[model samples]
Target chain A: MAATASLQTAPVPEGAPITVCEVGPRDGFQIEAAFIPTAKKIEIINALFASGIRAMQVTSFVSPRAVPQLADAEAVLAGIDRPEGALITALIPNLKGAERAAGCGVDAVHTVVSASETHNLKNVNRSIDASLKDFEAVFTLLDNSGIAVEGGIATAFGCPFEGIVPPEQVARIAKRYQDLGATSVGLGDTTGMATPATVRAAVRAIRAEAPGLGIGLHFHNTRGVGLACVMTGLAEGVTHYDASVGGLGGCPFAAGATGNICTEDLIYLLNESGYDTGVDLDRLVGAARLTQATLGRELPGQVLKSGPRLRRYDPGLTATAAG
Target chain B: MAATASLQTAPVPEGAPITVCEVGPRDGFQIEAAFIPTAKKIEIINALFASGIRAMQVTSFVSPRAVPQLADAEAVLAGIDRPEGALITALIPNLKGAERAAGCGVDAVHTVVSASETHNLKNVNRSIDASLKDFEAVFTLLDNSGIAVEGGIATAFGCPFEGIVPPEQVARIAKRYQDLGATSVGLGDTTGMATPATVRAAVRAIRAEAPGLGIGLHFHNTRGVGLACVMTGLAEGVTHYDASVGGLGGCPFAAGATGNICTEDLIYLLNESGYDTGVDLDRLVGAARLTQATLGRELPGQVLKSGPRLRRYDPGLTATAAG
Candidate 1:
């Protein structure tokens, strides 16, 4: 267990509060080919909240024709329970999406801008500056409506098309978002290109630029280091994290691969590391199992399959040979 | 990408050296139900060496009747290629296994003892003290044979049956191994129960108790925090790690799940973080693909499916919609 050889890091604080925001219904479901029924989506969301999940990016408000998977965003928002202290949010593309989300009474809306130019153009069919310009209107619409806005910078780690995004570029966007009244800014590992070094650089740059904005890490477990990135995030003192249930999403480029980090797995890590996530592991696993069954596929969530670490076994069970 | 927050870890040094040892053939293959052909095993072992793996636990010298899958351990040792600087080792149960390993010209031998009494009794059918008594003969046989000995403490973190395996229990075993001429001690996450707290505690205890013994970390990604555990190891300044190709192994208790941390993913994290591993990720992926093809089912490695983080795409392919 002694891993002391390189990378001298300070101790990770125990008993700290980490906000594990569930983005499964939006980020995880957006790429799923099958449209989960509106009622089913509400059931899953309600289950998550019952398990002590306080912050969640519940769904995305987009054009139904463009993304039919989330065409029932408003229905899902209406059908779900409003638990005390639960912060329900959604991803919004433009002013229309923002208006729809506000009408549905969401607590907040997330806005994204890619750090790299080419990726920005491909993802949203607009330049980074144009996306920012469009967000100004969305921000204004929700300014006095009690809806907090979180600015999400996609491809903040590295862009597949334009590798090694500079930390300064991400910081500039964060500065703009802060100036536009964003309560927090999230760094999205859109293609799972985030590494410890890149994460350190981008985090340090943003802290130097926008000291007032809260930082949330939204990482994808694409390359198997998603939770490892979360480890770095915890070390860096960032509390907010984004995860999906049962690892429901897959990358558009990497077919049949996991997308965002699994929510159950994230909670397991946080709870074990002495960070208070306020989640019940059994209930969260149940939620993950529900998602996996609803999707009719094997998920990439290891904890959900393995159960909790201390889960006992009968020694009499066979196949336990080692030598 | 910015992850600065709670843990005040110092800077992770770039361009440092980390020794990533492959244990797929031994710890991984021993658990497989089907017996891989000797030639195929040799091919996979050779491919791993060709990909610049400097250290490996090639096979185990247990009774053929005990573990049929690894019955051809001697044949595998004889048939595989040994490139210069590749340290080949194997698991030895007792003096007889040590003698067989010495006969196979292994560079080292790893001996196992569970930190928990129940797990020890279930794993090797002996009490903890009885297992140590058995290892005494192993150390004596390999003392002057030019084969280094590594003590492996199973369930060093926590145990499924016993719940929590105290760090003192693990360190006491490590001290016994050190006193018995073991050059290093490896803390094994046999049931994927290692957390950062347990890892830190065990590592600190060993360092305090046996200052001269080198430490190696053997972690399982069963609960999805295996790589995160590695992050803790790096911060603690320990360099040696054990992994499996394609994440071939699965926990015996958890049906159809990943066991060891993926070698390719570990190499990718280490290499991207500026640690020198001398591994070509593409070659490692090729090796994983070979294992997957050989197994005729999917393995749990994420980098094996997602490729390297900066892997480029043409954007001409469809399904790239986002906002």
Candidate 2:
């Protein structure tokens, strides 16, 4: 009943390995109004990988008519360099998208369904059962192609249209995905209604029902608790988190709000908190700068604007304020 | 050797009261570029008090020519309405500032000294020991006046001019504050160089050195992990935290950055995380809107734009993208 119910969690060991999955190419670019050039998208994706991002959702395999921004997904997948042992993934909505991704060089595909029934209908014009049934076809096509499947439960924390989603619902869906031979399940906080309470509830419920399924958390910074939620995830023994370069996306409901948590900031937090994310902080910031230069505006990343924690300044500079 | 040394902290109980100290009037307004009218500052401070802010750093008693924006500290303290059992405080720089606060209706005075010698010299043109020596007179006057003293240690986590401040340095100054009969001490993240490793080390050292002194944390969101650092503070059992309304302050060194952690967002996180701060979320958001309207532009607060967590939207609203 309380958010602090799961406060007594295991300590993440010093140098504990964590997987920071980059979802900017798919989740961030999909919502961007202007179409990012195909070559620029590949350049940013390659830069992120070169910075030691082993797992990334590079692009979405969707119809060009629907999301014009991600129309060149196939070309991007073909043109990008693959670092050894890197796992490139993409978002697939249906069997057709799955087939397209199979022809590309993607190692995995993330399939999504909304946990809220109302939101499920609003998002995909279908019921939860219908969406799950459709995923079966996607699973069959991908399984035959020997591609990994990551079940995504959107609105897993709270729904914007209908608030206070039940944890049992998320668990029940995760169990279904587990039965469908999925490798992992991602809890997506779309629209950023997640708090420590909902995150703990969903995670605990899924652990009980789908004990074999791996858990990943994808949070947006819409209400500004994204990284705080990440802290709780670490305490709860969740090691995989999704982040976007430059905090690129935005919520339609909240103006001037950032969508995904920033990549460089996450790395800085993890490295300082005794976790080994295996990502270079400076290289990640360089990629963020590249994205910012391409977009021609300041992103919502704080560490991007300010250098790392130990960065020194000239003693001659004027001190601004008393603490 | 690790930042996770204090990860095995006890849980903060449900309905456990947390002290949310509002520091925007002093910390945020003093650095604002324009001179906010004295009446307008009072209106915002009174509105914040009406929203159940029990403690506040109302203004700074500095020279008018130095920080003209907060020149009306006396007027602002007199004009604001005080709730029952409210503790109104002010930043006192010297014996003169303490005498001014003693005459005004201030419950307490916060005297500051930087832990880093270079920063202390740059900020106040004095060495750390000399600054501490000067505070002795201010403490004497305030002690006689029955005003509480909260000693502040600037650059407690790290310093910009001198990177990687030693936790022992912070503990030494905090012990000095204890000797001076201070009730509580604040660890200031001056220049936003704080991290979980540094926060843990400093809090642990202070607990060992001066167990009697109550601890308060003042963190800037300049590095995007301000709330994440607050998570570390909670794990360390540090309860009182200082935040600014509408994220009003800015880092002079880092462009496009915010200074203090936003007060409304902190309240929301605490409330959801099973702590009772005795502040209404909607009312706090309302106060932020008032501040934003008065400033004639948007503030950096996300909850101010997004509303509360359980806020519902129209189901008819279109979903922008698949999760």
Candidate 3:
């Protein structure tokens, strides 16, 4: 029977708005081969905004020739109409990318550094120290441009090359970013090698080291543990999450890496658990469907295919709880 | 970084041995057209036993014509030698089936009942009460027969025809079975429609009503939430999970349901998290590989395809902790 009183006793402090930072348009499109039209990118962002996704990573400001899929980043950013109270973000690899993102009138600029020295060299062709030095310039550029800057640590959980990243190394890089005046830090399981226990340990260690910093998570469901890690983050008192629409994303290092946790499905999960995420599941699914059609392939997010559980059922068959 | 003082804390008292019960040779083979040789089943069972899988739902003692795949159940059981500590289980539908299972000299006889009246009617062409009445005869036949009896609650999570199942209904049936002196209760999510929240609620309610009953879980990863549900069961202190070796089972109702969670991967998660499941990953993966070759189709288990996380690295490059 449906409990007359809800069994949801674990209450978070009242009136905390959990932020769902959308990374699909940037992260999702980057990995896929389909060179989506700039208009399609704008359309997807507009759709996300309509579905109550206020903050979105619209496009990456990387070198156009480097990432041809998002070559029209500036054009796409300019094409989408910004609804009221919406924040658009972009990824910046270096000072040049930061300048490009700041010029696009985006709300925030995200720069990333890999925790593993091997992955760091492969990712950006620079050592960890050299990447940090490069980021110093990117940080100064974003700081002078009056735009919010966020530091993302990729391969934070475990590295495909190095394997089993030590927590102290991740914390050390995070601390360095915090000292460099980053507004927030995003931890990425770039290869999806994290388990719940590892996630818990990492979160505990990071919180002990950097208590005041705003922390977010970017997880790829490569090994199918992305959602579990997300739950661990929830248990660790994290309120902000990063997800790609249609679960679209891939690791450059690991072959056959799966998509990120689907944004539509994640929204459905959070909203069903009495967490207010503001995103409309149906609208998100519609955008996901559009993206799937544009890509000409099936995406990994199951909720879009199966539909949400509670939404499909007739109220007469299942008992509704008395509020 | 490794804690200077080896962060290996005192082992938390393991709640109970989470039975990685295998039902593949029975439940998995029954629906397939592939007539696996009797020797193959014996080989599979012997490999599973070697992997420290103590309890195995080896075969179903159904009529030969009804399930031709398991028609050689008797021969398969006779061919395999049971390890001293293993609980070799056989599924029984009625008194005749129980007698047949007893003739096979198995450790336990498992019987199933549907909580939804409509599903019970459709499945066995009998009402819920009629099925329960049949259970009475089976229970009477097994009493003092030196064989343990376990009851399975199928479609406990959600039914295709009836939709959502209430916790009270699940608990009431479990209570009835426990009151009738069932040795254990196994909850089956036949349709894979359960979320972690629903699992937590239903399991808690059942435990509250049927205290001291050995509760086990049989989850299908059809909806991609199977592992998440497993994590929920772990948190709620429920051990004894039933999984197919290569996630082999399928749903008759849902057209393209995903298979059960892979046993090797499940053991990898549990063992890596410091739970003493005692299953050797390499042996289990070898068995999975053999099954895949015998079936001539790729299985859904990740570790079988990609190997474990440690397998990703070269032996020379891997650290001792990961090894």
Candidate 4:
């Protein structure tokens, strides 16, 4: 009875559209061993935009020496057609990267601060405190640039180096981001260690600490609970999510980490659950196919492999209806 | 506030241990292309038992011509060491298979009825009504055998040919099984089209139709929502779940059907969410390894590849504490 009651209470309200922030260009491609040509990256980003993804993390403005794969970030930013009203964001690590992203005219710049000190050091070559200090300067750079700042706390759910990050610690970091002029903050399951319980607890903690700040969830399917975590996040009223096109991307530092939540898969789930994602399933699958072609490999995405469940075929029904 | 309230109400009740019914030996091996030796099958079942799986579907007593993979059901049943208090179940197609399973000393026999008439014809080479008629004789054979009966309704969520299966149809079939002397009924997502909403609706419908009957859920990771469906099932208070070691098992008839939910992955989720599965993670991983070795291919299970998340290692803490 309690279970049924809970289900009734958490029903997805009619026509409540959720925003799926595509991170394939940034998160998904960052781990590639070979450098994807700048033109190809632009083509994929434009394809995603055509597929009705209005919000996306296009590329990261990091040191070329650090991540050679994303070395053409500036070229990609300049080459792609940025449709009016689209929110194009870029990941920035420090003040220099933020300045570079701002100059590239991104709608928003995302900065990262891991909850675990070890992970933060491994990810950005700086401690969490040092990253926060760096963010102060980065935030100052975007003060009058019309660029929104988003703070992403990596390893917010669980860390590869520091497992089972405390919800209080994540809350504190999120609250600090709010205090530092971030428009929103995202909880990153860096190693895909997030369970439904952990996702719910993190949401509650973050919401409690920063009441009006927008919260997004970034999940990986490494241990195969990415979408489950997303479901919990949805029940917690989280409408923003970060996903890759073909379930691409893996954490280089985290052992066994593989693939963010697949974009088409997440969109399929949202659409089936009666949430409007504004993304066309067919076009999205096309983009996923392009991603596979660009990478010249099979992707981990399912919808691209298995098309959406069609309506039942009736012999009496016309071919048009069946089609 | 509503999201937080919903989460609080649905918190996994303290100390409510969930039963994970391991179906790897039956479901996993049934899909293998190679004929696994009877001794290897028994060895895997024993290894699963050693991993603290108290209940398992060991083998299927189907026609050897129909499914040669499970032809050695009697040999596997006779060879394995059936631990005390373990529920050793076997799949039975009809009266003959049920009689064979009963004679072979299986603690229970599972019979399947597809909700979709098309799938029923394809699977059992009989109509739904014909299967029901056959079940009558099978029930009579088990009338006083002291062996329990479990009815598995395939395509209870959706069918490959029929597409969406109405909740009422699944409920009607489940109620029929309950009326025909089944101790419990499992709703099989044969084509993996089940969403959280559908799962909740099916649970509600079945509970309404067959009050006080045990309900179990069988899911496929075809579209990568198997674990998510499991989460929704857990929220709806359905404890018993069917999973395969190494994520083995695929519906040969269902297009694009992939592996079943991995046993180790499911155990990891249950354990992290505070549900006692009575399964040792290490031993279960070992069993998954054995499954891979027997199959001679990599399986889809993740926890078998990625170890459980360990706590943050502190330099001040001892190695044992860190470990």
Candidate 5:
């Protein structure tokens, strides 16, 4: 198929991998039962950077008690020395978080609001309008500090509390974020309730509503539809995606909610489908194995547990192949 | 999208749920390690039937030592007494197996051959030509004995051992089975290597080769493309599908292979998409629970653990309200 007009046409350097943002430290850690140490969080961020994932979301700057897992966000940012040209993003839930992210000399501050009213109220204890008001200030503060601002629309696909969320509503919210000078908009499957049809429809509507705004898809594999949703986004000309390292993370309200799509598996799918997701599968596996060892548990990522699809028989060459 | 020929023109009664054949007890169990007892096998099949799944694959008649899981196949067939209209199928690998299936009074005898020569050799321990020769007698016996015969093409999509089985080759093998008077044919993704593009190509090719034979898709969820393959099959006008209860089956060769597409999940998808799958989601979950309890282990179906998209609240009132 010809390249769709919605995708950026800037030709990638021959065989260069697509830029995959590893959100395990942020998205994955934020939902876990254990409060991972800032030092270990820094180790994960550095490991992911070494894995060829240039873009990483290391920590969320929520209130210390709200997501205790990320209470040491500042310490994590202080400990890690990022590579040149690497983008490290932090999830900023309010103006306070945005100020901290800007002060940390981070590449980006990402603020999340929900498309569903019930979820928005349940998530941040604020109405949608109240959350938007907070985000507006966060955007302005980040812009004045010359830091990039990414607005995330949670429950962009569907809401567990309120069943189906209209695509137009998601687009409307995203457009408002763009109007407020956000650099990019991320669509999140907060509840893992998206089908390929719904994902495509929402992405198409968002693109039409906010032209030239980079739209990224963040999915949870709750219903085992994470990669399928990613494929839908890919078919709709989306290149940027957010994946957790070991499929770690779950929505507090979505019953039986699972983790985000595994980075290794997502990279495998993209590589197999002939996309350039510039991630090294082996390196991602190494990071996952490290995280798994740290946590003393097996993760849900298939590729990490099963190994890469094709194993080559070379005594000297250690390169594994895709299935 | 407008309904295709099967959806638009099938002569079945209006509002009747489409049938899904649960193949877990038979096809799934035969391949893997879990050696479930005859009582447990009957329990699983009975639970599935109670879940509004009228048809199921109860067992396979391969040699006892070859597949020890179904060693008590005859006992399993004799044990379960289900609804009158409910049909149970048995997979028979050769003429002796078919004779046993006929003696056991199965509703259908399913014989499988491979589309790829290398896959056939690896799978059945016989070449494609030898398998065809064996299937000829099986088909002839079924034709004379008034037993329904369904032909399955293993590795119809692609093979792990032998890459990318040609569509024409699949059609040719399917035609040979049809010529021998097989009543229907099922395209097997033995390795779960099918994509939408490949499924569309193979289905279209096979339809042209054998217009009268009913074609079903038996897919594995190994590569996470099972549902995508199903959608392609649905688009190509296929009405019958074979899924395992709780996604039970996987290819022995494919180490990371999860089970086949779960029957409850597939039904949920079809129902949500406005297609009618007669199985009740809650009842399907109940069946999955029973199987899991019997085996004392967790199975892979997600919808069973997590309630259906449409949760039932005030069940008694809802039933009365429907009345």
Candidate 6:
């Protein structure tokens, strides 16, 4: 080869260990039309926990009338056998939800604040300032409850109702959450409007503002750039990511919103890219299959349908001899 | 509003202009079981050309018995309205295919060689060495035809029959293609087995061996890392990419292979990331819609369903006042 001498240069830097926070039970189930049986939900959650996933958002403590699909959040959270050192989180919309989640002994409670004011009003029935007040109330309610709080800024990239969300707006909300005692903050592409540039800019802006806060990303595969956004986030030193099994999850309020990044697929990417996630691929696929069985339909995960890339095929002796 | 002080730093660099080579006509149609009418193929290609796409892989001149979907390669080449300054290319398997393409006046003729020997044998019924010999014969046939040649190395990242192809093998094939008068070499993830790390390593290795060659990428969204792999390629200074409109391509020979990176989605990413691709988003979506209509089903592209991110949403004065 004429120029093989220059091939000695390493192309990719070894990335740090990444934490994949499985949000299938909460985010994936919340949007399903058919109600999943409580037992089936517990089964899937248990299977996912047994798959060596260290963290997960188990369910959301929202109003039963608002999200009937996850109305059995309390029962589902209480039924699963909590693994040692696992961070089991729950989505909470208000101080009441936070209190209920803390009572359920969840490791963390996640709250949402939209970067777009129009989206914030539509999503939480409050302005950004009102949401900040609610977050303060939630913090007060969770005081000394030993439960960590994660502030999630939705539509951090762009909004369906408001075209381009300013990164400065996201940074302001993130800073307020940090000052209000949030342990971490997550940026969400609620409408799947994020590109690599916007994702990187959002991360940098938020990181520059909340220098000491842990940052995470929740991406939708709506535009098919979910993993690409994750790659840019990784390059910018983001380690916490939220993914769904079987590529499940979508927003009913957000038009054209689709599934979140598939957990198995994200794991495959991170593992192949030299980032340790400590999750078992086979077990994750098993969980995805169980999900499909429960849902009575095929899911959108690639690794669930196509086995892992490292799977070996026995070409037999004749093929080897030919090679 | 606490942390909006330092929002002036640009997070993403202004990347160089990128070339998006639309391959829906050839790669997308190749695996489709239903035969698209030849007129419809020409219609979509013409629409794509009018959408400001500067290059496209129009069709493949392969054995009709092998791929009946694209049997009308010559008719399609003659029918499409070739735009000024557009580089319309065709996929050619061997000397005969190359001669047919040259006679049809294609701007370029593309050939394939697999990095995995098993994949090579399965794809073309020839060994790697035999494929090289065929390339040589094709080069001789097109020597004075004024048609450039593109050598596409299939299974360049990993193979279903042979797991984890070595970068050295890909570099060797690329080197030989460069020596044999290939103006460019495209690395194909035929099975969608490439991750960012492997994609970067392959690009670096291949670039090392063939410094003067124009390198392009053909990615499959099989494992959901298609765009991520493209992001890595962009970081490594690769300017050419192959995307299928509506993400409508899959490799029948490569088990579990799915659609290619969607052209509309790729343009959205590149344009949003500050790279000029000279593609019209709305017209591209129209072409994708035409493809979906032709197939009598919805395709996998998100931009086709969600519209572009820059699409303005009229919140009305009432909504703004409420916010």
Which candidate leads the pack in DockQ? 2
Question: lDDT tens digits, residues A114-165, model 6?
Answer: 8998888877678999989878988888777778888888888888787899
**lDDT (Cα, tens digit) per residue for candidate 2, span B1-323:** 00001222354455667788999989988887888999999999988999998789999998888889988989998899999978788998999999898889788888989999999999899999999999999877776676888888999988888898999989999899889888678889988888888888998888888876788889999989999988888888777889999887877788787789999989999999998788998998889999998889889998988888888899978874767
TM-score of each: 0.95, 0.96, 0.88, 0.92, 0.83, 0.92
After TM-score superposition, the amount by which residue B54's alpha carbon in candidate 1 deviates from its true location, in angstroms, is: 0.6
Distance (Å) between predicted and true CA of B303, model 1? 1.0
| Cα lDDT of model 3 by residue, A1-323, tens digit | 00010112132333445678889988888866768888888888888888998678888888778789988998998899897867678888888898888888987878888888877766777887787788888777767566777778887888877788888888888788878877567878776777777777766676667666667778777666676666666667777778998888865434544567779767765775567778888898898888888888878776666665643333234221000
Instruction: List the candidates ranked by DockQ, beginning with the highest.
Output: 2, 1, 6, 4, 3, 5
Model 6, C-alpha of A109: deviation from truth (Å): 0.8
In candidate 5, how many Å is residue A308 off? 2.9
Give me the runs in candidate 3 sitting further than 4 Å from their true place: A1-17, A81-83, A144-146, A252-257, A310-323, B1-16, B252-254, B312-323
Q: Native contacts recovered, in order, as a fraction for each?
A: 0.63, 0.80, 0.08, 0.33, 0.06, 0.49
Better model by DockQ, 2 or 3? 2
Cα shift from native, residue A182, model 1 (Å): 1.1
User: Candidates sorted by lDDT, descending order?
Assistant: 2, 1, 6, 4, 3, 5
Better of 5 and 6 by TM-score: 6
Interface RMSD, Å, model 4: 8.0
True lDDT of residue B31, candidate 1 = 77
Instruction: Note the DockQ of each predicted structure.
Output: 0.57, 0.77, 0.18, 0.29, 0.14, 0.34
Which portions of model 2 show Cα errors greater than 4 Å? A1-9, B1-11
Error of 3 at B165 (Å): 1.0
Q: Residue-wise lDDT of candidate 3 within B115-213, one digit each (tens)?
A: 777667666668777887789988888888878878778778877667888988888888888777685778888766677777877787787787766
| Candidate 1 lDDT tens digits, B86-192 | 88889988889999999999988888899989988887889999999889988888777788898888889987788999898998998999899887888889878
Q: Is the docking of candidate 5 incorrect, acceptable, medium or high quality?
A: incorrect
Give me the displacement of residue B296 in model 4, in angstroms.
0.5
